[model samples]
Target: MLSILIPTYNYVCVKLVTDLQQQAERLECPYEILVADDASEDAFKRENRKINGIPNCKYIELQENVGRSRIRNILGRLARYDFFLFLDCDGGIVNADFLARYKALLDKADVICGSILHPSKQPSPDVSLRYTYEKHAEHKFTAQKRMQHPYAMFRSFNFLISRSAFQACPFDETIRNYGYEDVMMGLALGRANVSVLHIDNPLMNEDIEKNAVFLHKTEESLRTLYVHRQKLGYCTGVLRLYGILQRMHLIFSILLLYRLLRRVIRRNLLGKRPSLGLFAFYKIGYYCNLAKERK
Candidate 1:
């Protein structure tokens, strides 16, 4: 038996339900879908009731917004099966055989990870650009490298793990929020000597609108970095190099801002609008902050 666990917030419940329905239809074996919602203030509870009629789907809404790590940990503990598949509410099945593929290799590895891909088009330019960049980064890994690479810590969008492994090392709720919980979990699994198998299956990640409250999210990322730096002693040389790159990226960003303004004034650009590439700046800033915390 397999338990498909999803963590949801706010209005994303609609897509979450739809994706689960698709997964249920496509899966060849029996599975239960569990949605652990973080007490969205929006109409998700009402919406969830309307969709409760869907088969093999269970929804649990909390009284408040507990962070993702805690929510997932709760789901893991509550899951009925010995094996669990963790899927982001926004992720959907790419092929009919995705569940079967994971099932085939369950005995050999403690964790099996699937690849994440983006849809062909997106509703918003900002969202489209972000998806395009992330898709590029995710696909850069080969199956072997993805399975064993040290950098695999950077990804956690799609994966499967045995309930026993999860029981041995549940997500670090101390990390809180969204950033490094996945990395910490992967590291814990490594320490336990659990084999991580990367499946070469493409999974679709639906693009969503970027939140206007971006700075708040960045702060969460920075907090996560601080915790990671404390837990894992990253090398000093790498730390110094990270600071230098961060400053360089910030300088280049100011220059790029001016260039972007000039182009916008010259003519109306069609197709996808260019992003300021602030994600790189955020990453560099995170590394720099981590380095500072270490000092």
Candidate 2:
């Protein structure tokens, strides 16, 4: 009794749903795969509508685009099984036993984060920022490491949760943008004292945005965090650093350095070989810039 819930936007997921359908069929268990398209483009809508033809699968297209948080909530409410497996539409079912792995652990904990993996084969430099970031940080996401700080490491890309747990701590609907929703969920789940079990079941991240696009999304996520920092009641590295700088009266110095190096950092990040160190500074500076704008 598992519900495979997927939310899509401007991306075709017939293949994803088909692969999942086959896996569920093998389990010989009662499972339904639901794909909710968040008012994607006409092409994607047409392509994903074919998911309905697959056995034990249904596709629903929304009239209006409900942001990321609401779309997942919509699918959670629509799910008919005791357990819900939330997978991003762009995920590639690399392992045939993905569903089986989750099914084996359904009773182990209140929540299970399957985690995500970038492609083993690196992409071209033109679109490697996200890849580099993910690859370099891959060690940090291992089951052993994640278990140390389960709540902070919880990711939404591929995770399993009981329907009861989901209903108790749903994604914060107020977050209409792209960042920290997972962190917020992790916090809420922690507050609810929901048991989380980290496992090695990973889905390959099939879609990696180009460097510039990812940079923009990164900024949007930072803005989201900054906007809702109070509600989050958590301190990310960026937030912690920001607070320290503010308290030490060093904000102005960092702002000045950031302004001077902004162009250089942008150039490096957009180039073939980007420096992750500079990328880190860019985020701090960008976040500080946002704070300055508000004041």
Candidate 3:
């Protein structure tokens, strides 16, 4: 009745698959778990290969990395069941009833987003940047708040959608990058008037990147947003600020200020005691810099 689809790149997912398999068996539901490895390292590939031993689970390794978007589309096509559960490889099933919760809501809406949860306590100092950002904004991630702007808040990290709905609006494979794939999908679903329901069910996000790695990925996401700004309709607040600054003729001035303080901001972000306020400024400045370069 459900197809659990997980797309991975250089991460071992044997434990995640095994955990879900046991849950499905207990519920006595017809489910299959499919894990797609996107040309990961040989070590990760060997570790994830153990997933095949689990009943109704298959580990498919690709010779080439098709990227974040296409890999999901490929999994959608490979799904045999009516409902698809997409989860990231680096996450864990914290709740024992995660699958059961989704099973009960199979017909509640066209799409159900089970938001992600971060660690309660701060992890290592190296990973504190991401942990701090997520924890600091935990209030906004609750089900009630997310339901207020369902489409805008929709994340592909963990969600369930029917086969017909997924086929109607698949992930845009043209976005061969690290970010905004989920935002694009959410926007498409909203435009199509697809019903989205947000629940309290959250997947435990286990993999928190180090400060340098998180900042690098954040920049990558900004680059993706800049490249597809037109298609994205500039929905983000940063872009909105950019528009406002442009009308005021302050784009270059702000860009100059950003250039002056770029090093200082970088040092803090890479440090143990990073500030989210500064992080926001860095993103805005980086995005503004991208616009300046394009012009």
What's the TM-score of every candidate structure? 0.77, 0.98, 0.98
Clash totals for all candidate models? 0, 0, 0
For every candidate, C-alpha RMSD to the true structure in Å: 5.4, 0.9, 0.8
Which candidate should be chosen as best, given lDDT against the real structure? 3
Query: TM-score of the candidate numbered 2?
Result: 0.98
Regions of model 2 farther than 4 Å from truth: none
Candidate 1 ranges beyond 4 A from true positions: 14-30, 211-216, 235-240, 243-279, 285-295
For 61-180, candidate 3 gives per-residue lDDT tens digits of 889999999999999999999999999998898899999999999889999999888988888999878999999888998999999999999899999999999999899898998889
Cα lDDT, all candidates: 0.67, 0.91, 0.92
- Residue 29 of model 1 has an lDDT of 66
Ranking by TM-score: 3, 2, 1
Looking at model 1, how many pairs of residues clash?
A: 0
Better of 1 and 3 by TM-score: 3
Put the candidates in lDDT order, highest first.
3, 2, 1
lDDT of 2 at 241: 89
